[model samples]
Target: MEDDMLTCNSVESPGPPFLDNAASSVATSLRRCANDKLPVSDNRDTTVSRWRKHCPTPIENDNIFEIETHCKDPELCSTLACDIYKHLREAEAKKRPSPDFLETTQKDIDTSMRAVLIDWLVEVSISRKKVTEEYRLVPETLYLTVSYIDRYLSSKEINRDKLQLLGIACLLIAAKYEEICPPQVEELCYITDNTYIKDEVLRMEASILGCLMFEMTAPTEKCFLRRFLHAAQLCHEGPALHLEFLASYITELSLLEYSLLCHVPSLIAASSIFLANFILKPTKNPWNTTLSYHTQYKPSTLRDCVKVLHRLFRVGLGSNLPAIREKYSQHKYKFVAKKYCRPSIPADFFQDASS
Candidate 1:
């Protein structure tokens, strides 16, 4: 099967690599900031069927790894996990922000300004800044906040002056939904240097909720990434945890690229997993039958998205927006932001074994 995407020259690097990726050590397989490349495991030669898929594989093969064994953990919602996630998948469309809002609706702002707002939001959530203590919003809250900003912008037009205010209101609303102890509205107001009064923030919050029809439970890339990572982890023991962090790093990088709005959350999650696997284990095929079954996407389906994300990875390494790169480079996150891979993915990797 010929991949027509390669001939299109979509993945070709226009200039320098973009995304900021690095990792902390968990023994020898993981690398520190100095090691630009992730060292392949000593067991790289071992053939694990779960990590590498084969055709005509028995039906029980995929289930055993993701369900039969993983669901045994007491913390997991084992009995209802499948049904719960099934519903989330069904609900993604309703929550998806307008993919082309910048072109169709907004007259005052463009992609760069939206990118700037997201960068600021990242700082508001996790960075150490003006406040005596960091605000520390959850990752889901940030994703939801961005969704709210985009969804609200999809229908309404506002000038650049109010963009930051809209971001503040969205973050407050998202923190309320996803955080156990949400931030005080006044504290959020403080984060903005009191640019908008308390009442103004509250009014924007009301506007956002009303515009969204009060539906706050929309699914995000992070929501589906957890499930896809479970399937991707299967039997890969040494790199499992690092894989999660690295994949997440890739997904977050995509948030800065407004063009990615067109792709659905599930596709973004699956593509991030694919890219992370290649970065960590370049010698082996990244996508297996298990991933295909779980994500309901073929390697071919993820071709364009993976390439676009890789472009972000290459460009974001030295991007002006340093919040995501700086945060992920910490020791706790395994320093995934600094982990480097080959400049370009091989065109053939997108093809299945059967192809």
Candidate 2:
């Protein structure tokens, strides 16, 4: 009986001098490790095997949160009910690019150059409809492609001559990551008008992967928007497609402005939802407890970001980025670009919305 008691104590103890604290604290940590739902595994081998199969290998300095289940009901799962928000918060905190990711101040490139490159890439992605025979690139792929470009550009210094090559390489990487059957490398070369050989594209891909340290899972605005949109739906049971389209336009516009890079994806997402709600339902409050609890942003907190997004939207009305405009101008997108992109927002709308 004594030997059994000793074994049980050894199992219950958290195994380290620092963790050797009150039983309550140790129990809390163990609960957290099990996502606060189940008791810790008593069988050490079973615990190890379970983690090996289900949990991702921990990275140094990563605040890893164990998600209990995949969120099928976006409202309950994404909000305070499940571990999704905790996981998202930890992932965003862990994966955010450094503030000085861009070395353009010392290099030949500048923000204007980056914007132009991104604009051209947007055109290329849209033009894929005419170039590719079978596959049409999805919006997620475009977002990811741009993300890869920005992260890679922030890390590596390159001449303007190779900028298009870099864009193509990033697109290939994104397609592979997001698409089921990505376009061929030779096709990607052809889309660039053959300015870059297949070998050069392959080499640039290697260089980008090396610079990024194989970290391609950076959170994009779309990831957060999905959850926020679901929360918005819980309150507004009306047709959500309009708000979704407008929010997407807002997000895409954000992608063009280099200054916005300083903001995290979650902030951009929350602000977009707030803006969309303000425009669609002028009388209703754009935010509430559910949104705040899930997105970690109150209405006042989203004010500055919403203002910035509003400025970008207004400016984009007159800007020369025709690809985005034309893409949204299509009937399938409900002409959201033409309908919503404008210079004048009523001053009283902001005043009323905030209150």
Candidate 3:
């Protein structure tokens, strides 16, 4: 396979990997300032004075080990964790699509056509999954790949013939961004049964990067889902594997619907967890103080989006895109999809819990 595939060495570097460092620095400085051990000077006109007012402590130590040790304190680490989530939420907000993003829907493409393409892409992604037993591609990469396709399609019009080409291009971009070793251009072409050539894939890759302004770090539903899952786990006492698998099912189902793209990724994540909890244990409340604080979504705020997700889930029962269902139905995924039930949702399920 390595001998037959063309590598993507030409893809531009993803640029400085400083996000972790930046977050750590912020956390450390804030921690020191809160302790008030930082030195203050009477020279208010100096840069150091201004820095003292804000950062307070001078970062005299460049020792990575020392900084790591300081950050390990749970009380201080909580502050760091809060800062991380704050930064992530802000980034997600900035990357969120405009309310009219879907208005750019191509005249030639309708819901049915889009669904067919997504169904096919889902299979291709699964095939990629099977190629390597070890180091399997992360599920987040697939979500990102589909997100890139939708964002690109929503922004530009293309003939139905080029849809597959666009799909592979988006996959390539996402793989490069998310995976350590992305599939070669040749492998992607082969996956499509040679419907597209390597050069065509390359050209489309360049075009997609251009259209997306090379902004491939957009916040994806999977990112938020992981965070929310962690938060939910802290509150729930039951076996969480079933809840997790069902929430993942709901998340992937949302990816198939074009209308759902308008909602932010975090909302989709929160709603998925909410819906999954409802399915797993209908009598109990899903949202708690811990989940609400982390996800920033009360049960009431998630009501409308949860309703949309439930409708999509119900519709998927008879829909042609069974790739997600089939994938989850397998043993390794705990066969959550096979166990899915369409139980009667309470009429007030979507109502505000507090009311």
Pick by lDDT: which candidate is best?
1
lDDT string, candidate 2, 1-355, tens digits? 9999888888887575354458759788887888757666677446434544532332322222222233355445322433444566577766665545555422776767667777777776665643346457777787788888877776677888888888889989988998888889998887777898999999999999998889887678888887777767666656778878888878887887777777888899999988877767666667666566556676666767788887876667346666676777788777777664335444544342235
Q: Give the alpha carbon lDDT tens digit for every residue of 1-355 in model 1.
A: 2587654554684433443333212333343533656444455224233334432333334344554345556566654556666777788877788899999999999988999899889877885344366656679998889888988999889999999999999998898899898888788778788999999999999999899899888899999998888888884555677999999889988888898998988899999999999888887788877887677778888999999988877777346689888889999999988888778888788986457
For candidate 3, the per-residue lDDT at 61 reads: 27
The parts of candidate 3 lying over 4 Å away from their true place are 1-79, 97-105, 129-135, 317-319, 340-342, 347-354
TM-score of each: 0.80, 0.72, 0.74
Looking at candidate 2, the ten consecutive residues that score lowest on lDDT are 59-68
What is candidate 3's lDDT per residue for 231-334, written digit by digit as tens?
Answer: 77666677888878889988988887777766888899999998888777778766665566667676777877888887876667345778888888898778
Instruction: Point to the candidate with the largest TM-score.
Output: 1
TM-score of 3: 0.74
Q: How high is the CA lDDT of each candidate model? A: 0.80, 0.71, 0.73
Least well predicted 10-residue stretch by lDDT in candidate 1: 19-28
**Judged by TM-score relative to the true structure, which candidate is superior, 2 or 3?**
3
Candidate order by decreasing lDDT: 1, 3, 2
Q: In angstroms, give how far residue 77 of model 3 lies from its true place.
A: 7.4
RMSD of each: 23.6, 12.3, 16.7
Supply candidate 1's per-residue lDDT for 150.
Answer: 88
